[model samples]
Target chain A: MKNKLLVATRKGLIVFQRDAVSKWKVIGAHFNGIPVSMVYEDPRDGNWWVSLDHGHWGIKLHKSNDKGKTWEEVEAPKYPEGTLVKEGVDATLRYIWAFAAPSSDGSNSLLIGTEPGGLFRLNIQTSESKLNQSLWNHPSRTDQWFGGGRDYPGIHSIVLDPRNDQHMYVGISVAGVFETQDGGNSWMPKNKGLKAEFLPNPDAEIGHDPHILLASSKQPDYMWQQNHCGIYRTENGGDQWIDVSDRDGEAYFGFALAMDDEYPERAWVAPAQSDEIRVPIDQKLCICRTEDGGKNWNTLNSGLPQSYAYDIIYRHCLINQQDELFFGTTTGNLFYSSDGGDHWEALHQFLPMVYCLTWAD
Target chain B: MPKVSFTKALKRFYPTLENKIYIKGDNISEILDGIEEKHPGIKDYIVEENGQLRKHVNIFCGEDPIDDRITLSDMVGEEDEVFIIQALSGG
Candidate 1:
């Protein structure tokens, strides 16, 4: 089994091989100074897929069959040529925030979520990417959806139902959660209970900002989201949502969210001060855990920075796989916990600002 | 023939992208073309689809930066050294 953590950072990619529960050795940094938004390792072939976003040039996708040793550019998602470009709307891919291949089934199809708020499905058989025009051209998107700090709307989280690959969920900043039941042919907004206080209409169809979205790996009906306003949970497959943020509301405004596979009710989040501040609350960094389905939240800060910790945790930087939770901070600190979210230990510090983290199981 | 060398930073992508590569070309364009032919995906990093050098990439022929980036028609001799440098950008 491959026991490694692939950490995508602002300037490059770092692979950490686990030596023990507390020991992780840096394998090396790949793509040196290039920005790598996310890295996903193909399980069947043991190949690697990386989403590279150049600050000035644009976005590209690369595939490395021999792990990270060598890479070759592959077909990336692009808008159909001759498309119109507007001030707020985008016609082409600007950055790749998320990439997910369907779970189970040997199909070589890939789902890519990009900035400017677009979702695309690439069928390897045809070797062509088809934009989900339904979501892009949705009537409510143009007027309702707003930009985040990037100043262009984007899909930041993608979750494919492990039990049913056909059911997919995507989280778009300043837009909210979108679900596609009939593959990518159609989409619908699933933000019934989430809130976006910034918008004039608090319950608008679109324009809700969901920082991170996760579907329970074991329970197809369970879903969780850490949003711009607060954290939410849905037990009825997104038909409706409930605000289950910590009652005390210390770090309620955070981007990172993680769900435990063994216990569907157990989850984790790292809250920042607020949308404007974008730092740990009170200058202390901590991981908030919910054991009773968000009824109450407990702060976990044993091994984390306590004071003057002005780091922001990106959505994809916090990951939980096989009962192991990993944390990647914007300040380049990495931590891991084996005993749920109660205790943690530092794995590495002083790496590049982390953009994404995924475990190679 | 002008010899080509890539910045050390590029070795992270391809360990084989060593410094100081020997290629046979009379101009900067052909020299890069030859290098891409030898090293498959390096050209995409250095040049755009419009055939212009990438914004972050700069090519220096001997002691001077290549002035004509579009055509890459800058003259090169048998003993000239071509350097591909990654331009410093925002922090």
Candidate 2:
């Protein structure tokens, strides 16, 4: 399994290296112009966290122990000093978006997902870097969360619980789906039966937006979500949720989700244009598989791009493993499908708006 | 000594921060404490964890904008330049 790929672009962090005759190389760009939102690598030691975002120095968390070659500036997820702001929200800790890599069981325990919406937890195996806020002041985060086109509200999907490393899971765009057995110390709102037409009470526990949250590393209670309004599932882990968006007439809102760490009834989504014109639904460019999880759906668009092709796909940019699924697009296009989505390839073209796609070893 | 400089949007987040930095201060808060003692956290992106002066960060000094942004003292000159700048948060 020697494919590296780490694409997290909006300007910076793009390392790709396939080679073994598959040929895909571009291991350079790292922090170049800086707006990376996610990039994690720490298979245990290769150390590299890098989740920066500086529309003007708002969030910065870097660390690269030889992988990106050199870097250090690590204490980044804030909110500890007086910390208590909920009336119209303003505690300021903008943008981290995601990072759930830790749990070799040695419990170096790192799990972040921030941006006006918080959930930090960093341990770093101990060298005096302890972070641990455990869902920050999360009593539904005051007056019940909200924000999706930015004004603060982010924690774009972070799932951990291969089998209960304290069992935690989070995905909050407008705030929905949150769980913690003990690791995060008290929290619950599994978003029961999830759906939020934009809310007037489309079943709300806390705002509901979740635009990507997949946890089923081979069915750890089966879960999958991609919701601004549709596409959801949760067999048990989340307690209750099951919209399973096939949309019947096709195009179920869409943000990007990928399960199948080894097929827990496989999954993958990529439909755009839920209206406000987000791109590629009727403009045609697809990748909508569901080998029985969401009750059948298959529209993997042969080699994709059937028409004018607008494309957006950005919720950590759709990643997969066992049969390799990878994705990238905001118009900078970089697709892949080593047999999981069934057949596709368009390695690179233009290359910049991807946002986040992972796969390290 | 006092040169200072910065703006290139503060190199996004201190991409080595070197637009010009001479050092040895004599005001402007000792040249921002000698450029934050040689760039360690770059004065929290131009001041305001409480140090104040981040009303969209301005500094200047050689031409004038540093109106004692919280006792910056404003005096410098070894061939003073200063500058700093901020306002340009996202296009």
**Predicted model with the maximum DockQ:** 1
How displaced is residue A203 in candidate 1, in Å? 1.2
- Chain A of candidate 1 scores what in TM-score? 0.94
Residue B89 deviation, candidate 1, in Å? Answer: 2.3
Model 1 interface CAPRI class: incorrect
Error of 2 at A28 (Å): 2.5
- Interface RMSD, one decimal, each candidate: 4.4, 8.6
Following a full C-alpha superposition, what root-mean-square deviation does model 2 have from the true structure?
18.6
List the TM values for chain B, per candidate.
0.94, 0.29
Estimate candidate 1's alpha-carbon lDDT, on a 0 to 1 scale: 0.82
lDDT per residue (tens digit) for residues B1-91 in model 2:
8788878977755678788878887888777877877777777566644455655677887877877886678788888888887765554
Model 2 lDDT tens row, A1-361? 7478889888888888888788778877887766788888866666778777766555677888887878887766556544544654336566788877656566466778786777777766542323345566676666678678887777887788866667778888888888888877777889988878777888877888888888776677788887878788877888888887777645488788888766766788888867478888778888888888888788888887789998788877988877778899988899888898778888887887888888776
lDDT of 1 by residue, A1-361 (tens): 3488999998898988877764678887787787899898776667788989775445778888787888777867777754433554336666788888886657577788888788888776665788888888877777777688776788888888887777888899878888888776678899998878998889887899999888877797798898988989999889999999764777488989998876768889988987788789889889998888899888888878888997788989898875678899899899888777678887888878999998774
Q: Which ten residues in a row are the worst by lDDT in model 1 chain A?
A: A81-90
Compute the lDDT of residue A53 as modeled in candidate 1: 77
User: What are the lDDT scores of the predictions, listed in order?
Assistant: 0.82, 0.76
